[model samples]
Target: MKLREEDLMDILVGATILGCGGGGSLEEGWKLIKRELKKGRKFRLVDVDDVPNDKIVASPYYVGSLGGNSKDNLAVKSFILLEEFIGEKFFGVVSTEMGGHNTAAALTTAAELGLPLIDADMAGRAVPELHHSVYYIRGYNMCPFSVVTAYEDKIIFSRTRDDLHAEKLVRSIVKVTGANVGVTSHPIRGKIFKRTIIRNAISLAMDIGKSVRKAKEEDKNWVLSLLELGGFLLFKGECVYMERREGSGFTIGEFELQVIEFYLKMRT
Candidate 1:
């Protein structure tokens, strides 16, 4: 599917909701999209099943805590370096996870590389650690991964003891490289990727986004429509208290919602 401006906004809205407050910022995602659009780049998504079995694909994402000041094209740079190191062209780019920024990172990388963005991702939701991916859970190796820091420090791991160790190593690097880096990892053939990925996840987000947009356009109740689409009304309240801190390359935070009422139900 070719994504237009409206489609980008819809995806961002849906992905942000799915991110559960951890997928990077919507403003960052929009900036990436607008930058690519200004360059006349096309954003396209392809189904996993449509990929050839022999084709090679990789997941591109950012790793580190929120809030950073880096002007380098880190994700794209990492992807290019990985392709050079592997001596093989990537057939497509898959997202590491769905979120405002990560999804935009993957999409922009695909656009810059003139490749299709796979509609699937390693994780259906934004996760805090590298080990929290479906690929890791399915025993996929994240070897030969490339990491590019904001300061232009590039490293590639031919092997790692495990995904958890990989996460630790990257976090340690982040401490010196401005607390953020772009990563391209888990280079896998389309066959294994299809089996391990959270299939149609992008489509799911797009559908939710479209529903919400339609609701807004028709002046309908978006919350009700979302519930009808299998969303649960978890809470209707105001955040009475909130605190957040950055540590260990992760955002540690807490919030208390003052509930007006608890209306939890699943629409049939």
Candidate 2:
């Protein structure tokens, strides 16, 4: 019960705050994680040092879709599909991608599997695609990986030597799944994890969230504290105009935001 309901809610809200306006919504991600938790399940966290050297590691998380009308709580079924497709007992580290929702999703899987979850991640920051991970650049395998789509709960099992191919396959499946399929990839060895993974990412995120909470509770500046934690300065602007549409699973568009006497272009 280390990750209680209140803890999950705090983490979700804190992550959205930490997201700095670009990470996925806390509400959607929280509902997904909470729904799975309510199934009377348990989750655990493990330090990277506890993992074995040669054991396999993988990350299962939500992929596809951005913004409104995204995927929801059915992601648990995806995990079940993944286990069915692997058809073998897995013993290794479990990690996350980078979004607030993905981070929670990874932890939820670890909790359900009774596996020692690693605090690291493939991407130090959340990106729009799968292959954009340090694991992809480090030559990790993406097969023996599991993906659950929306078609009658059928799981797609993929094994690829190249991570990009795996990403492409996942994207294609997402298109078929209505742009929001759950996926797991970048199977790697535990011993070499330190080399390819972004160390302490989960814990780092947790710590960041905690700091923000403490700052807010103490009537201090959350923004300043958050910025000191790793957030980069994007810009300051007022919403003047915007347009967007989903194209190939991405909400492609541009926004015109006025900032004093300056303007900036942001993709929404």
Candidate 3:
């Protein structure tokens, strides 16, 4: 499906919620979307099954803490380098995780490259470490990955000891790159990609976004709409305290929610 600005808004809203407060900021995501739309770029979403089995897809995303001022087009550069290194044209671009920033990153990359954006991702939600991806959990190789920084530093890992080592090595690079970098990795054929990915995740996010938007338009309770969409209302509270810091290439923090109400459902 061809994506419009409204679709991008829905994606931003849904992915932000799915990010669980870790996939960069909503502002950054919107900035990227607006920039692309302003440039007359077109975004397209394709289902996993629609892609030819022989086709190759790659995940392009931003890695590191949410706090950063880097404005370089690192993700696009990483994709270009990876495609050159692999000597294969990518059929589509897949998101590394479902988040405001990363999802937009993948979408913009696809739009810029004139490739379709796959409606799937490695992780259905944002995760802090590379090893948390389904690709890593399923024992998929993460080599031949490209990492590029805003400062024009680039490295392609032809091999790694394991996912853990890859994570460590990337973190070390991130520490020097101002806490963020762009990465493209996990090049897989469509057959294996469909099996390993969190399929239809983008659609799910879009659905959630559409529901909330409809509720708002109808002057209904968006929270109730979310509940109807299979989301649990854990608590309604004000954040009394938050301590966030960028350390070791990760954003570590804790927050306390002073509960105003809590909801629990009983199943029988």
What TM-scores do the predictions have?
A: 0.95, 0.80, 0.95
- Model 2, range 1-268, lDDT digits (tens) per residue? 2566656665555555544444455666776677667787665556777667766667777776665333443344565565566564445445455556766677666666676567677776667766777766776656666666656455565656566677777777766667576666656667777667887766666767777778889999776676676664457668999887666755567888787643244333
What's the lDDT for residue 198 in model 3?
91
| Residue 2 miss distance in model 3 (angstroms) | 0.4
Which portions of model 2 miss their true places by more than 4 Å?
4-7, 13-23, 67-87, 153-161, 230-235, 260-268
By TM-score rank, best first, the candidates go 3, 1, 2
Q: Any idea what lDDT model 2 has?
A: 0.64
Clashes (backbone N, CA, C under 3 Å), per candidate, total 0, 3, 0
Could you give the candidate ranking by lDDT, starting with the highest?
Answer: 3, 1, 2
Q: What is the lDDT of residue 62 in candidate 2?
A: 72
Model 1 per-residue lDDT tens digits across residues 1-268? 8988888888887887788887788788879889999999999989999989998999888888767432467999999999999999999999888788888889899998899999887889888888888988888878889999977889999998988999899988887665679999989998888888899888888888888999999999887778766888777889999998887777789999899988766455
Runs in model 1 with CA error above 4 Å? none
| Candidate 3 off by > 4 Å | 266-268
Looking at model 3, the pairs that clash are: none
